[model samples]
Target: MAVAAIAGGTFAFKALDKSVKLVVDGKTQSVSTYASNVEGVLKDANVKVVKRDDLTPKLTAAVADGGTIVLNRARPLAIDIDGVHSKKWVTAYTVEEALSQLGIDGGADVSASRSQRLPLKGASLEVTTPKTVAINVDGQAISVVSTGATVKDVLDAQSISLVEGDFTTPAVDTPVTSGMQVDVTRVRTTTTQEAQPVPYSTSEQPDGTMNKGDKKVVTKGVAGEQVVTYTVTTTNGVVSAKTQVSAQVTVAPVNEVVNVGTKEAPVAAAPAPSGSGAGSSGGGSNAGAIPSSGGLNWPALAQCESSGNPKAVSPAGYMGLYQFDQRTWNANGGSGSPLDASAAQQTAIAQNLYNARGISPWPSCGPKLLS
Candidate 1:
């Protein structure tokens, strides 16, 4: 009986000597034969301790018989929050859980989408707050700004100014967020003047004739003038520039008149016959005394043709009291220059008629015998 009791005791002692296997970061470790939980295994392995250490199955959970223990070492990481960098140690199993433990909420005003995965161990994290702001000037839309600060801070960064008449949607002191919009506008005006050239009237005298330096009222041209109205533009009560919009002529101009004349006189006749017979006494025999028989009345015709003036000329180059052309005078029985008559003009006319027609009658007593 004593021998049987010793064998049973030996079997029980062997079962109690069985040790637990601990696995940490893929590494295997054998714990004390007395280890029966995760805390005992970690204590036996002498693993580093930290504020947010991670353990599989939990620290307070009972250890499985012949099962393994897994421990994850927390790594030191740096974080940059809106340009401010800070160091932190975490081991919450995942990036999201680690951040949560560090007092960072995923639903905060500043957040990152799932696409922006958490950083690796010993990596840095960037936390940003996106802000939106709207700008307006004179009730007009100007610009929209997205930033991570107050409205004034964004405006200063963009080199924008807030004036008396200018305004912001949420007010300059309002906080900024992502997707905010802004607007700005300026009130202005302008002034200007325009000048126009006045037209003048021109007059030309008749061809080959002039007024001989005499001033006439021929279309007296008066100077013309005009005035224009314009709409000026200005900004902030200050005039910028002006332009002419409409124009009109106030008064009409007057035209003057002129007159002209030819300065040359008519040609003179040849000298009369000499002696007493030249002036008078050629009465009843006058008709018969005349030489030419062309049927033309000599005395009455000559007086009428020349208007009783010895000097006369038609525009067609006819000359003398008889108004004889050069060709006709040359064909007569007279001599010397046709235009210059010492006594030749009258004699030429008489001779020409007599030769062309024929003498009708002859006289011996009236106004006679003067060569």
Candidate 2:
């Protein structure tokens, strides 16, 4: 009876024993455990399971004979996709397996080889996917299928260089995306100088030495010269904008000086001979002596009215250096069209008209007579 009890105990022990195949992180090994559940079997084999680890069977499940158990140890991994960085817990042993489990396919560019082993502690990986983008530059449309990480990478691959004033629509540092359009605008800037005329100002001073209606020029006016600098921008070989950046006066204007008469006449010089004098109706007034110097600026008025051309004729039937109409010319002792007379003759008539009108005839050009 004692021998039979020992045999029965041995049978019970054999019945409880289980033969299981244990795979830890892709390494296979056979384990023999007398424990009843999966947890007990793993404990007997000295295999640890963490929350982040992948376990094929539940810990509380009953252990079966000749069963397979898979336990993939989770590892820390740093991943960068198109410049965006992230950390992931992956249960794969190799880079290829990790990518597959992360839903990454073969068309992506990776920093490490697909078959490289993923270390248990940690490993870093950079990924770039193929994208379709249109590049418009230099008046041409270029289509690209690239695996670059950013817009700058794409441009560099195409041998495109950016100058100081050059720019892109989507900045060069921007991440690349599918179906994104990139426009490169070629800019060229230049500074140009141009000469500009500055109108001269007039100033007047009273002089008591001259007669009431007499005037004398003391200084001649000169227009000033200025150099204007412009910032000209050209885009794609076309002028886009021209902005005035600076202006410098190279030559200053010399103001004109004139003396006006403020003295009273000496009793009209005892009413001298009135024969063929100024303002006379004689047909020979062209040879008559008329005072050239006057209260107004006659030369300036002629320059403003007819550009100093004595024979100048206006479309309004006005003629001569003073732009006189026919009726006014006849009233001012002018014969026929003022253009038919000599410059001296025209001047005499103009002086006679000025003595009568007091600079009211040339309304537009009268202001130019100021000192």
Candidate 3:
């Protein structure tokens, strides 16, 4: 009976004394206690356990031999939700648990990953709740719930496609905000013709046959008309880009060709006497050079008519420097063809004809000899 009492007393003393380890947040401490329960042990260590704090072994449970009691103090975790600053007191182990404990669900996007454990001192996490946004495509508006960060992401999320000549308002690279208005414009191009004036070109050539210092227009230039086809792109009733596709000339341009004379001027002859008379039958062929008669200049008129060549002929079978036909030469007291007569004889006959006819013949080229 004495040995049994001693054994029971030893067992009772061993039960009263327990070895336990306490871990608060990340810190650890050892405590040798005679407390019988977790509450008693917490009382001995001067640790007050609250309902919000986490405990590995519950405070109401009996203390175990060499067992651990982990106390994670509840802390308020800051949350940024839709630009609203909020906080939730939690005792969860990781980011996912914390959100779940706070009644946050519905596949919410957390700035921090779910696997990331809570630190000793809690950190912040951003919760972005997806919202519906309206997108305008080709003047049609459509609404969709999206968690996209940019306009392009939202369009791709909805399986919207974009091709060449397609554009969007607020730009496709811009970040999407809640209730943001997105406009998409479709561009179409067409080939069109526009009439345009084509300028004419000028060309010059040297002409040795024309009189020296003389200018002539070989061909007159005219400005032509042409139609140019352009590839024009229009976006929602607005012009975007234009480029020439093809060109056609309806009226071809005429180039101006001008003749530039390079010929040498003829040398002026000695002035004949103003009173010099034509040869009479009495004086023979040694007649003085006649300059003018009856208010008519003979020498200059003969020069203009036939370039002062006494043996010159006309296309109408006219003869002599005075351009007379055979019948006219005989009527003017000329015996044979005017080509057979000497310059003095031809001049005498021309003077007689001029005196009688009063300079009515040779009107076209004769007026230029007045000066």
Candidate 4:
């Protein structure tokens, strides 16, 4: 009865022991045992906790009633760093610790998984470590160590400054290559003033009292002065770019004004009847009424040509006292038809013709005018 009682007492002690919850790699289970510590609980559950495995409520901590314990079993982590592949067990669940364990500084670029926690089974890491590169900027060669992706990224890593209107050869966004030559041309702007000439303009005004088709200049035109501002850009100590910024007139130009006539001409007096009336009433009265000008006898000439009838028209289309054609009359200042002119006006035009060319215009009657 004593031995049976002791066995029953041991069973009661085990039954009254603490109960602990275990979560392993996201799987949950309840465990009840007479365990005093985390190691005891793990041993009772028959779980192997290696040095690289993550265990919570550490192996030395005491087990409590209704307490939960978590364990994430880590796996082999394979990483390629500096062109070398290495394999190891990492207890840390995050990739950052994995990189640190591989003796890699934070100056390298890891695949996005670097920031994420380790997978349940295992993980692979790819790292692009910084390397030396040579670049040319503004004809100057430079050396730098970088893990950037493009030419622009390399420049940004070196703390380079770029402003508006600046450019580079081979383009900045192009992918970076080993020993690539990049030429950066620095651009600077400068303003300058230039003297330029402004051309003058001419305008005309109408004049009614003067002869039609006649023009006269009233004012002369003069050219003005202007100043032009230009923005000049120089690249690599060379002047090759220019742009006009503004233009200001320094002197106003004067426009020339001309007067154009639009008035109608007066009508000519009609010629007298052709006969002894060739000299007009001033020459019509007597046979001796010969009016002489420039030492020429006009009456004798007119008597021979028209016989005193000044308004007569010859079969040859000639008219007036001097037997003048329409062409000759107009050329001598008579308007319209010669017969449309007064005898006095015809005689005056004849006198002008005689004065300018002597009695030669009379032809067969010229000798008589000189007589």
Candidate 5:
């Protein structure tokens, strides 16, 4: 009985010592044996902790019974995702496992290695990874963007717009990867009036009878215009650059002016007939008298042509009341060289007779001669 009591007492002492209560986060838990540390206890309870998570009582600290020990694990992970800040917590044993457990994919920009071992107590891990994408705007190639998750995310990062008629190198819906390119081209129309100075030119009338100062219409003055299409590149809703892709002329210009006249005079008229002349019927009143009915000034003509000297002889070999040359006097049917009044009157009568018959050598000046 003594041996049995001693063994039972020893077993009871050991059992009491092993059965200790642990206080964690205000919750009490009973353990039958000593564990390595709080981290081991949390692992046994299937509680997951990440490097970014808050924790109390470090993993390296020893556990004490009834000491109100807090089994808080640390799980801290800092992620730089396309210039964005992000954090995650995981109880995974490796970087790859941690990301997977946190619903992160292999395509994500993760800085740490997938097979990299981590501390059991959890430590802060920096993931400096970036998703690469190609960008093209308005037919211009841009450098690959390093950090973006979705198409919209990539555009937002680059401040690019996705509008209708805009083209993309890689469709906007395409997934982003390393060195992937995305292009955007927007369609635009521009209207412009281009005024070209048309040089003036002179034109003649249709009638062929034009003079030096006369002018006519060559081209009417009309305004010219053109319409063009362009592809513009924009960033942050502002136009960055533009390129003309197509153009067309909408209107053409015409020129305009007034006209002036420049012409020479026509010929003169012939002398009147003797019998049909404007004179009195009586021979005594009209035979030796100048006609007064015609608009011609006989006195002025006599003074200018013969200088009141019907018998005068010019040094140029001309004679008679009109100073006619020998050839002209003969052509006009003058009887002889008229050096006196009577001879001049007779010669003038003969010339007038020939002029009335339309047999004179001079061109008829009826159009331009003054009465």
Candidate 6:
């Protein structure tokens, strides 16, 4: 009786034991378990399963002999799309498989090649779909159909090079999109040396022989020469900014000496007017005949003020040869617009203003006369 009970117990044990195939991430192994269900069989085999893991059969399914249990382990996949970032868990073995399982389109731009296998700890990916874009650069418009992830990639695909000080609109790292307009500014820098005139100084000496308003030039002024080095920056063939780097004097300036009269002239009595009323408009009539006087360089002042253009008008409302504003023109015995007058009239009026204000009106160009 003891031998029969031991034999029956051994038969029952053998009947309950089941042999099945277990596959973990496509790697197959034979498993032997006496457990009744799929969950119990995996536990008996020491297989750890999570919610994200893919199992071939339901955990509650009854375990039978010769059954196959497949478990596909899941891993994290980090993704960035069109600047938006996210993480997803997948049970795929390759980049193509992951993308396919995620329902991502095959034509999208991917950071990794599709056939590349995922690492043990999974991998990261960036994707950008095909887009139509327009780029304006170097005086030309380019239309492109591309699958670049960023604006920089698009530029790189076109063999575009960005040097120092060059830049692009929307930035290089900005994500690309359909119908986007990109502007590329090519900055070119150049160094140039120019000879500029250095202004000379004027000195005055008193002369008692002549009348108060009378003056004479004792020594004429000569401008010095200087080489000015400039850093010129241009964008797309147009000058954007110019900076002076250095200046070296090549020639010393010659100072001007003038003899200014100190004697007070006697005031003449009023001339008797003829019945015809002659010389009523003496100042206006002698416009073209006015000579350069007062010890100052009148021609230089005119040239500097308006580039010798008598009909020049400034954007700031300053008009005529000397760039005089309307208020200053009217205050200095000038009637009507300075533009309406002749070149000789403009010169005569500028001279009259200089006599009254002593070069205060032409503040910017006044120093140019010394040069």
**Each candidate's clash count:** 40, 1, 0, 20, 25, 0
Cα lDDT of model 1 by residue, 324-371, tens digit: 566666666445443355222453355444445444211322122221
- Clashing pairs for predicted structure model 6, backbone only: none
Off by over 4 Å in 2: 1-16, 104-106, 159-167, 187-235, 239-371
* Residue 132, candidate 5: alpha-carbon lDDT: 57
TM-score of 6: 0.50
Cα misplacement distance, residue 313 of candidate 6 (Å):
38
lDDT for each residue of candidate 5 in 145-233, tens digit (9 for 90 to 100):
45465566678777778666565656666656667766576754333333333344444344234332233344554555666666665
Q: For model 2, how does the per-residue alpha-carbon lDDT over 1-371 read when each residue is reduced to its tens digit? A: 89999999999999988899999888999999988888988999998898998898888888789998898989999999777799999999999999988887678899999999888898999999889989999999999988888899899989989999899999999999999999999999999999998778877677888655455568878999999999999998899999999989999988888776786533211112222222222222122222234454555565566655555555565665667788888897888787777555666577667766767887777666554
**If the candidates were sorted by their lDDT against the true structure, best first, what order would they fall in?**
2, 6, 3, 4, 1, 5
Is candidate 3 or 6 superior in TM-score? 6
lDDT of 6 by residue, 1-371 (tens): 99999999999999999998999876799989999899998998899888898998979999899999998889899998766799999998778888999888778889999988776587899988788989999999999987887899999999988889899998999889999988999899999999999999999999998545456688999999999999999989899999999999999899999887787544222222221211121111112221244445655565565555545555565675577788888887788998787655665577667666677777777865455
On TM-score, the stronger of 2 and 6 is 2
TM-score of candidate 2 against the unseen true structure:
0.50
- Please say which candidate is ahead in lDDT: 1 or 4: 4
Superposed Cα deviation of residue 273, candidate 2 (Å): 25
Model 3 lDDT, full chain set: 0.73
lDDT of each: 0.51, 0.77, 0.73, 0.72, 0.49, 0.77
Compute the lDDT of residue 34 as modeled in candidate 6.
Answer: 96
Once fitted onto the true fold, the runs of candidate 5 whose alpha carbons sit more than 4 angstroms away are: 1-30, 33-97, 100-129, 138-141, 145-147, 162-165, 196-371
